[model samples]
Target: MSRLMRISIPTIRVVPQITPGPPPPTVAEAVERVVAFLAPGNVAVLTGAGVSTDSGIRAYRGVEGRYLNPNFKPMFYNDLIEDSPRGHSFRQRYWARSFIGYPRILATRPNPTHAALATLMRTSHVSQLITQNVDGLHHDALRTKDPELHSRILELHGTLHKVHCRAHHTVLRDEYQMQLALLNPYWAELEESFRRTGNKPRTNPDGDVELEGVSFDDFEVPACPECQREGKVEMVMKPEVVFFGETISQQVKDRSYEVIEQADRLLIIGTTLATYSAFRLAKHALELSRPVLLLNLGPTRADGLPQLEKMVVSSGPVLQEAARQLASSRLSEDANLREVLEGGIVTSIEDV
Candidate 1:
């Protein structure tokens, strides 16, 4: 049995880790610790935008869990629901910026961290790979390497690859982008020019770039096709991701909790646990007396919590090294099993 499994569960709720623990581990120490923690397998991996930063998606927060771009306001769920000029303008701005930025997100490939996670999943080390990112890069990476393990990934925030109307009419984001291009030919040309010149705008993690000195007042946003067919005046379509102030779907929340409950331990990567949704999972692990390992740089919301180990290091390299060690161990296990089978000592079978 693992050391983590022997820990006693707290009858009281686990609070956030506010006080500091020991000094941060060195890179070597961090790797060793990560390997030992994950070697027991059945680990639940909870990642955030930080994991996708290497693939060119900017994380919303800095190391300390503060917004990286203080001036930038995320599109709110309330803004999308308001039936006023402000809402219309907000919709226009969002779609216009998304039209320009979505292509870059599509163009980016998953990074080393994604590949390492996939390797871990393939080796049966991870019980659940839950990510707060909406970029769908994890899905992309898994499809390429560990296609069978795709079901193990739980996207806490909905994916950017899909768009939906207020009535829940959904469409493929690529098709919607083409529709946007058809509606706004001039902006499409501008986007093409920007791409050609290698002058892409910096985008937020939600796949929208900041635009200044550019007016989106005239930019067109297509209504949902089903809504249009049903004679609805304007059912604005938006990316399927959970907007700021929006609650995650109950189904997703239930699944996330289920995965956390079933795992032996929780491993957090690339996130500071700024959001309660992600932080709660770690708290749940601690509450269950299951160990929580955070492999992220800077301070997390749960930084000082007992039963949680924080390693201040880049997650990519640490994950890569851990995957390597785990893979090697798996090969050794397979060889041992093969040798046991070759010995022909299991000729007799007992029915239970």
Candidate 2:
């Protein structure tokens, strides 16, 4: 049995090592200790919305998580494409939110956690980064410097930067222009609604929008490109996101499993793993006797992972300290990039 499994309890204590410095041991100290435990082979990082919180994105399960009238419920892949009112409803809310929210998301920058992981990849410390966030921040972070050293960021959730047709699966980029043109009057109203209510829509872990008091009739939906070519142009639809009662595609599941199989340790940052799809993946990692380290401010469904090592804390400062240490010793070239990841989570250890 692995060390994690050998432990009697579900939890393990993490004691920070104190050392003299301008600042004392921070959350970064904990992350550094965890990263140091990773073996030389494949070190897989399974990240969630927490990593992007510093980048101005809101997490779903914490105090800042979305919980409103037009609140989001998980969707399944099967339900998204099926012709039904529920599916139509799901698609409508998704497109409406995406049409209004994608631009704001695109304007966000990567946080320290992202840069640290990318640096880990460049220095051969990390084998792969498996992320549930679809904001494309990881991809964007990797692009800031050398393309050759760009880390391999496996986006478990589909990316928001592009859209695909449900019927033919023909992918397109920057099609927001077309969506805006079609949305017309409704688009203006939606923007005005947000402004009037001072409501800032948050992007969920599944890459869907979270809102309230909004209906499908308020937005325009586009039609498939392939179907349009065949003179069957109808409202083009894309799954708002993979939802509940739905399974992640076999292809996506298989790839995620493959990464899990190769991972020596599973480091979970900022996710509660509330959904079955993400929770099952963490469970599989635990069953393999892999060490599961969780860093989030709330309780996770997978808190029972065998020999789980966890810190119920915010991600920002913890990741910042980790980046600071790593950059000074091994990633000196990208010191400035690492600081951006440090944000609101910087409270004293006593506060935690």
Candidate 3:
């Protein structure tokens, strides 16, 4: 449990300027500030669903600050573990929708924000990148673009690419989805048809699609293979993600705090910080007196904190510009250092 309390501070809201002027900073100025903020490096980034929204994933809350799907409620942790028909039904609905949505999730490519972050991570500008999304886009971005620096990212919410049993037995989500396709061939074919027609279902931030006109009760749920080998009868596999009412693992919490402690500043991007886990990180950074910057599209839970600076702007463009400027600056610095080294070498040889 985080014991940190929020410190009140005056809010400085800077909406991106279309015309570069004085009343509000231009987008270029905002980019410069972001670059300067990252100049010292050791920036710990805490991202949310907003980061992946550009990749075609929809956030829970929209720009109007309301739930996009008012009728949709996420499956709770307790409900998933309950040994009842409801639990079975929940699993059926979850897997059925996930079966249809998995392809889209798999097909999603990282957007500009991810690309910018990858550059920063590769250059050591980011100390740690913690994401609240289970989409695994950050992992994808880093793995493909900056493979060696992939370890810098910590998926705060467990990823959708994994499934786990109550016994903690884990398996790749792709393998489990394959099992689902085999068991529910009808839905599998339907998903393919949907893809062919270019009418895919709306996907939630968690990677489950909003499916309709289907009987989930008839959907077959796959059991944990490890548990089944042990003679377990009931199917009890769940996505390896933090559900609505679940507590995050202690290991992840500790690791997040460790990075925040080492970071000189905290830059929260693409999230409203609606969840406590994400909110506490900002609070933790403030507790440590580390400067915090929110580069989000809208109001966050930590809006009025004294140590925090809120920049309400589109994350993609600002981040891209910042990364470009930082990379250029780094290259210039390296060139200058090399020049100095060469000059020193020539001087030493002449003296010899």
Q: Tens digit of lDDT per residue, candidate 3, span 1-352?
A: 6432221212222222232212435789889899989989999999988887777777777654456677766777777777799988888888898889888878777777887787687677887899988888777665444455667888887899999988899999999989999999999899899888877677777777877687898999988898888888647888888887777777888888888998999999988777777888898899999999888766667777677888878788788778777787565666532222122110111111
Ranking by lDDT: 1, 3, 2
Better of 2 and 3 by TM-score: 3
Task: Tell me the whole-model lDDT of each prediction, alpha carbons only.
Answer: 0.77, 0.60, 0.76
Model 1 pairs whose backbones collide: 17-305
The true-versus-predicted C-alpha distance at residue 346 of model 2, in Å, is: 11
Write one digit per residue (lDDT tens) for candidate 2, span 1-352.
Answer: 2111110112221212222223323565666675575435467778887677777676654532323223445544555566777667766766666666665666577766676666566555567778878777777666456655443567776666666665646555466546554656767576667657756666554444666676666455667666778888555466323434444556677777778888787777877665455667788888899877777665566655568777766665565555555555544455544443332222221111
lDDT of 3 at 242: 84
Ranking by TM-score: 3, 1, 2
TM-scores for all candidates?
A: 0.85, 0.74, 0.86
Tens-digit lDDT string for candidate 1 (1-352): 1111111112212223345546777778888998998898999999988888777678777766567777676678878767788888889888999999888778776776887787677677887799999888777665444455788999887899999987898899999999999999999998999888877677778888878899998898888887888988655677888877777877788888889899999989998776778878888889998888888766777877776877778877777777777787564566532222122111110100
